[model samples]
Target: MGVGGIGIWQLLIILLIVVMLFGTKKLRNLGSDLGGALKGFKNAVKDDDSAKNDSTDENQPSENTDESSSETVDITAEKVAEKAEEE
Candidate 1:
């Protein structure tokens, strides 16, 4: 049993059909674009989490919050998604 009842040969045939339909160049571009989007999403989520954690830390001094945060731009997940879709 290969992949929930489909045989190995069946899988290969499906793959071949897909390759024939899309061609390798288009498939490669699609794969890379998808991968890049996923990577960007992960980074955005990680950065957002880290920002939240830092803000919640009691040990950090609250003095001059505006001055310290001025250098960094806050990126929301929605903005990231829109940019990914554009590309």
Candidate 2:
């Protein structure tokens, strides 16, 4: 009548057997490791979301567009010089 037909008593028996086999210390260490792994995964996901937001913000037009225009001009000059040298 429980999960997949396994009752609460059966689940308790399984947990007891696992504790007996692994000992309390090993189980504690395993729990902590699992907790740390989940925490790290959460932080990574948060950082990825923030990075995406930052990229979108940068793509929007701003008043300081002159800086970007100067960079484009520099790139164009470099390409023109390269073409002249190839001629």
Candidate 3:
């Protein structure tokens, strides 16, 4: 009357055997390591998604390109003026 046809007592006995084979400390360490690995994998997936979004945004044309190009021109002019002043 437990999980599937295996009774609660049978499950408990298997759990006990496993615990006896591997001490409590080892089991705790293994559980934490598995949790850490899952957390790291989640973070990596998030970063990859954000990178893909950024690349797609750059690939598409936007209204800001003209403004950005003008800004670049102004910066170049300023640098040229500074060099002329230095000379």
Give me the candidate number with maximum lDDT. 2
Off by more than 4 A, model 3: 64-87
What's the TM for model 2? 0.69
Better of 2 and 3 by TM-score: 2
lDDT string, candidate 1, 20-86, tens digits: 9999999999999999999999999999999899878967776667765666655687799889999
Q: In model 3, which residue pairs have backbone atoms overlapping below 3 Å?
A: none
Could you tell me how far off, in angstroms, the CA of residue 1 lies in candidate 3 after the best superposition?
Answer: 3.1
lDDT of 3 by residue, 9-52 (tens): 99999999999999899999999999999999999999999999
Candidate 3, 14: how far from true, in Å?
0.5
Better of 1 and 3 by TM-score: 3
Q: Can you rank all candidates by lDDT, best first?
A: 2, 3, 1
lDDT of 1: 0.91
Ten contiguous residues with the weakest lDDT in model 3:
64-73
> Hey, what RMSD does candidate 1 come out at?
22.2
Question: How far is 67's C-alpha from truth in model 1 (Å)?
Answer: 28
Q: List where candidate 2 sits over 4 angstroms from the true fold.
A: 63-87
Candidate 1 accuracy as TM-score? 0.64
TM-score against truth, every candidate? 0.64, 0.69, 0.68
lDDT of 3 at 23: 88
